[model samples]
Target: MKSFFHVIPVSHVIPANAGILMLVFLGLFCSSFGFATEPQAPRLLEVGVSDVFVPQGFDDNDNAQVVVEGIFPTTCYKLGPVKVDINEDTIKITPQAYFYHGPCLQVMVPYKQEINLGILKAGTYKLNILPDCPENRHTLSIAHSTNSGPDDYLYAPIESARVVSKERPTVRLHGVFSNSCMSLDRVVTHSESNRVVAILPIAKYENNGACLDVLTPFHKDVQIKDPLKGRTLLHVRSLNGTAVNVIEDF
Candidate 1:
């Protein structure tokens, strides 16, 4: 006599995660040019930043200066960290930044020269400086490349939203939506105990929809009233509307 056991294939599970992660990285690289092979140093005069692009092999001690052709060349323009070696004579810039949505970011900072990226590595990056404030209040869409000649990289303005802590007691009504339209009103029941953590109105479109910023009080009843709460389920009166237990807690 012998005991029988079951075995699962490694190729099936591991490959899926790897593929999904690669896709996510590619999407991020496309989104806002989150990876930088070179630094972007654009000088500004009055209102706009110009001449933005890191010199080839720009190092920590490089005094790479690009002529700032603006109305007022004396205006102070804060530079994002990139191993800058700035002096009264020249301003050196390197490529490195950890950008997050915040204040202090207003206009689209343009690059000095058009970049022709050859190859890149697998990592996350941001082109500009992190706004001094927080992500939720930042509204400006900073351009990554300096080219209005139909070959520029333009990032869409993204409004900031915060994520609530899971350790803290909170109630979250998860829902599905498409193109800013509510798909179904399927509010999760038995959503008490947890503070109505955050009613995340996921904007499927590049823009539009109210950003869930106003921290509504922690109440399960009120959470249910959110427009995005029951967005997945149709009315019970409609045909094919089946009552399914979204989630059940003891």
Candidate 2:
């Protein structure tokens, strides 16, 4: 007769605490491999700011604004709100992007956004975009409030714009004036760097008798004739001390 006792292997003998730990380890491992039942959620990520465009100058009453450009590595990204932190003379702008929770196309998308920083007191300020990089930055200068003659006025707010014809290219700007006293005085077009024709629409304020408190709609067409085989940038001056940009292939 042989011994009836059976011996269990050491590997088969798992303590109660070890079993719980193994369960936790398996849970972590599954999560690491995205094997959990939970679905991925959308998120926002900081965009890589490439350049910032600041105005040549600003008056104390001027609404300061800057154009920001950045790139998105994937097509699943959409333009997000800009986070701005102003501390004394230093302004920090963090461009953001919304990431869609799904398989995104591997493509680079360039984006340009205009940030309106309402009137700033007369002073020189440093604008830092993507402070993490420490290189994407620009300076803005705001002149003290000087006597503004009747002839001087800010460009009207450009609500919407478009290039009517690429052949005899003309940019059309449609916007509204604050009141009936304001009117489109003239449109001055000048070609700047990169063959960008800047269309500046100056508004004229009439102080003769009284201006009716009414919103006035105005449409102006600016003729910008140029030959750029690849593309042409239309940097049009608008309200808020900013410029609206329109790209067209000419």
| Per-model TM-score versus the true fold | 0.16, 0.62
Q: Measured by TM-score, how close is model 1 to the native structure?
A: 0.16
Please give the lDDT score at residue 131 for candidate 1.
22
Error of 2 at 192 (Å): 7.8
Candidate 2 per-residue lDDT, tens place, 1-250, comes to 9989989886678765897899899999998998986876768888877655565455776666777666788889999988988888888888888899868889999888888787777888888878454743467787776665311356787787898877777889988887777788888876644444667788777876887878778788877655544555677777755567776667
Give the number of the best model, judged by lDDT.
2
lDDT of 1 at 48: 34
* Residue 248 accuracy (lDDT) in model 2: 61
Compared to the true structure, candidate 2 yields what TM-score? 0.62
Separately for all candidates shown, the number of backbone clashes (residues 3 or more apart, or on different chains) is 16, 0
